[model samples]
Target: MHRKALLTLLKEHHPVTADEKAMTQATIEFVEANPACFERTLLIGHITASALIVSPDRQQVVLIHHRKLDRWLQPGGHADGDPDSRAVAFREAEEETGLTSLKLVSPAILDVDIHPIPARGDVPEHLHYDIRFLFEADPTEPFKLNEEVKDVQWVALNTITTRTNSVSVLRMVQKIN
Candidate 1:
């Protein structure tokens, strides 16, 4: 059921950039070929969900300082067997940022990304086929940090590059602009 929904979402999604267009196609193909794509055990790569959370006013974005990656990034994590990417994105955003008032900007996917995760412990290097959603929340909300992240901050949308140079991040920023 999840696989079918994801395939439908991918089919309806219209990517905003040439790079994202390619990634979306690749993600669709990957999902079609891998029934276990929602599981992290799919060592080659797996589906992940992310939230690009913007302030209610749209001037700032919520970013987290990831402990493992050691970079300021949007709140996200593995699907962990869940196929509802929108729900996953919302859950991760709340878990990572401790913000309770988050509202989905749309039911449609905000972005799609495929990036490599370095080998760690028992896990080998693999790609993260990320499906992202847009959310809006109060930047003034109190935060509770989980062990997975070092810190969380509300960053100006225009200054995102100062935090991380991730092409995917920049692309999402551009999409909202």
Candidate 2:
């Protein structure tokens, strides 16, 4: 969507303070004006989020091995006009993983990472600003993998860094302590 139109939609749906609104608007403008800038620029430019579904004892986390990317990642996607990015994160996690009984904690903003989309054979390059958020789920809840993921498993925290996850995902795990 165009920057101005997005800004207008955001304002109409999820009103924020003048300063916050301006900042969000500016980011939308910058992203629309220079799509390439997304690859390098980090921060709040693109407000996306991920759900870090930590185990009850905080010893492990749920992760999805994305089919297309072939890398493990926390479940999440674009906010898509949702005012609460945390909600977006949780929703995506549930939808993608088929675990509906998860619960978010006190809404901790874990960390943010910007990375380029892998070069699909025919797709243009894009970028994602992954705003990670911490959440918790009952350890016994049954999980069903969805097609968006090639595999889904709960991995120990120590094993996370050893996997083929992005460096950003590792960094998010580091912040858990």
Per-model TM values vs. the true structure: 0.97, 0.71
Considering every candidate listed, which one attains the maximal TM-score? 1
lDDT per residue for candidate 1 within 49-103, as digits (tens), equals: 9999998778998889999999988999989999999988999999998999999
Q: What are the lDDT figures for the candidates, one per model?
A: 0.92, 0.67
Q: Which candidate ranks first by lDDT, i.e. highest? A: 1
Task: Give the poorly placed runs of model 1, Cα more than 4 Å off.
Answer: none
Clashing pairs in 1: none
Clashing pairs in 2: none
